[model samples]
Target: MPLTFIDIERQKNWRIVLFFLVLMALYLLAAALFFAALLPGPLSAEPRFWVFLVIAAALTASIHFWFSASNAVDTVVRRLNAQPPDLKDDVHRMFANIIQELHVVTGAKRNIRCAVIPSLSLNALAAADLKGNAVIAITEGLLSRLSRPQVEAVVAHEAHHILSGDCLETTVAASIFGTFSSAMEKVRYSSSNRLFASPAFLLAWVLLQLGYLVNLFISREREYRADAAAVRMTRNPLALAETLHFLSRGWRGAGFIGSGFEMLCIVNPVATTLDETEGFLPDLLSTHPPIKKRLEILLQMARVSITELDANAERRSGRKGTDAQERYFVMSPARLWQGPFTAGELDALPWLSPLTWVANGKGKTAERAWKDPLLNTIFLRRLAGDGRIESGFTCPVCKQPLVTAAYEGTQIVQCGFCAGTLVENGRIPRIIARTGRERPCTERLNALARSVLQQNQARNIYRKVAARGAGQVPLLPCPKCKNPMFRGFYSTAHLIEVDRCSNCGLTWFDQDELEMLQCLIENRLLPDITVAVKD
Candidate 1:
């Protein structure tokens, strides 16, 4: 309330309240003007004039009530086509836990409901009713891409929306805009059906546009407030800033939530070029702050420079403690477990066997030894000798045999026919990092990929592919665990569809997808564990 955001100089929380009051007065004036224009010439009696004024008042009041009392939360959820999350599902459970933790931090009394949109878009929308019922709906893309801290930061941001009463205000404003827009639509329809048109319809249409703009302005203010509140609550403006920056890389899912519901989301679903002009005019009209501006303000709040943030990220990305030699146990050729050697010792062992099993930790048995992901990957690579593990199965897309190959020190499987690569779940960050360092985009693939996946063009491609049933591809079994894989877009930005195995967390990428992702990573557009998460 006291200018919580560190950078803003003039605006205060009360200014938003004052602005809403002015908007309300403007709405009333517009209603009066609408009715006055509709009046039939000079009224003979004062009572007749009063009647016209009363009718106009009633119409405006009806719209306000229609939106406010009409089960807004449910309407919003339905508009997004979101479903109640299944607690049994791992992703769903993670979301539920994050929301619960945020709720606890905020200490809000009202229970907040959560849902999943089943969308691959990386965004979250918050909505609430006048009665304090609130809900937050998250897209699957967020769960798939963002790390726990980043996600926690995002959930905290939405939670603050609920706590600070932004959801109710924004919801009411959205409802009013929608109702007025619908009224204008009916008027247009009537004009088309009529033999003669009325001039008042033009005035009504203009007024509705003004009303929607006012709602947009208020929504933007609410976003800033929520951002500040979230930082205050979580003490991690860097995470939210990184998240916003990451999301701005390419956000084309606004159409999925529809134009009417776009304002409810954390970031504008509409993808704007990172190079878009930034000034008072654009910021005044936008539903959310410019992504660059938001990042700058957040960085200011964190009291750290972008260089510091990057350095911290690099530090976090260092090798995990498993690299140490004190925890590994290898089996000898005589079938007896050897000393608790380090990872280096195990790697340097004289006789590593396909039959020989190695485990980490003191109590780990041979049965559970393979459960360690690092160990499993290392053992598998060693077993293959030449770093090619045959899957004994053919690629569904190309019908060629799949074999794991070592690339950039990571074991990834590639199909012989299409040359598509299949990578284990936790290995993506490593692959991206190594690829960025070693195979930096020498060609202008960054420019090419960006042009190909430009916001508008990418959005159109998504719509066409989604419409033609191209987004739904047949599933392929996991090469390691043999579990059924789920198919989805890798990122809405790149529009590269992939199949991911939930059981083993492995991702299969078609040939073109691997190339496309290499470009994205080289351009520093991809999310990695060291910078944003721990895998």
Candidate 2:
């Protein structure tokens, strides 16, 4: 018979009890050893001493366990700097909605709160405390990038952990010893040389090792149970499978998620060799089952092979099968009609602009390049590069005077108010090539660049699949020509959207978009195609 939530919850109670008993035993052993070292005699023969030690150990263990586990949810929230989802933000709003839906679906069995961790790493964790508090926290990077269904799958997976009572157990275990480990890490990094030889430091180190005992109790199989429960709850095994594949390849918050908390996460934040291997030792020691095995199970339930899933994911990452074969004729600077050229050839022409008259072929009516929707994107690409010269142009978005700014040794007009930039078509290549010389890309900028690229790639895939463009934002007029600029991706390959003026040969990037573009090119960050494809 399939296990229900009630059945899972009941079975977990014994495990939690066992954890407490084991914790008391560890404390008793430690106390007995400490007394033996101090007294210089065997205390095992003394019944009164044994009784006193037992009582003291039980009291100490009770205090330690309660203090650590009672406020675990709050402790985790503070440590992660997680905040409640902002209702005003679209992505955060969607997350909040999913939590509400979860509450309804689960019959409000527990009041589970939702939070968003500000880090850009992809990971999510659940925490529950003895105070009846439960929270599902997802990193901003993961939350912003996943589809609605994928997010649903992740949330359900976490929810199952909370409802099954394992989250509480894990939180308690982590709190009991993980707290000391975290403190020791800080002390080890920040303390003086003398502190390393201190007795307190040695005690903390021993406690840190004892924390690993908690991991022994944290069966890797619980993750499989959660995956199955998530599927049962969401009825979308494929979504969960895709999410796992994505997480397995991407950054999973290794340095940021903290140690001793891996058991609480959907995927082990730190991907260890043991977590990916299957053996009696790994099965006994690891906190998460192998991702490949988890994916196999989920894919089987979804009734699809790993190959088909990978292909679908590839398409979603904006990998096209074939390039479009449209050709065009152009009106040259000398006013003579040029022969039919591919879009690539048209882009190479220096004089091509919105006002340039162009024809499709023999009988097609001649029209301005800007009027041809397909050819207009060529101008947008032209604007993506860097250029300098003050033409007394005002910012399209901020209405402030544009200042000539030197970026990568080239001149570009930038808005002092909004920090947006206007670059001419000719300077983009120079700017891209000159990146990382004077201005090295910071880790924050690189992360942002990858995130923006992934978002645009997903948007592009959606546009192609739906056969429609995304909802249009208000168009910005050209600072020079006063004509509305064309808004679109820089190119199919780059996928960074920018506004270009076909008339004036200009492009505008809002705020950090220009920097993100440069960083992307410098780092060669591509769409997330590293999805695991193990059988």
Worst 10-residue lDDT window for candidate 1 reads 526-535
Residue-level lDDT of model 1, residues 1-535, one tens digit each, is 4543232322335645775575566566566655654555553448877777867776776676555535778877776788888899887888889888865764546688988888888888888876667898888887666777787778878876766666666776665555556655655566453312445545655676777566445545567777877787678898888788668765548667665566678887876552244666655666676666777889999887877766665465453343334476777878888877766676677665333576667666664334455554555555467656677655655434578677777777877535678887788878767765555664666665555455434544546656644334446777666666787667655455678888877788876566567777566563221322112
Model 1, position 401, has a per-residue lDDT of 51
How do all models score by TM-score?
0.50, 0.57
Error of 1 at 485 (Å): 45
User: Which candidate number would show the highest lDDT if scored against the true structure?
Assistant: 2
Model 1, residue 437: what's the lDDT? 57
Q: Model 1 compared with the native: what TM-score? A: 0.50
lDDT of each: 0.67, 0.81
Model 2 lDDT, full chain set: 0.81
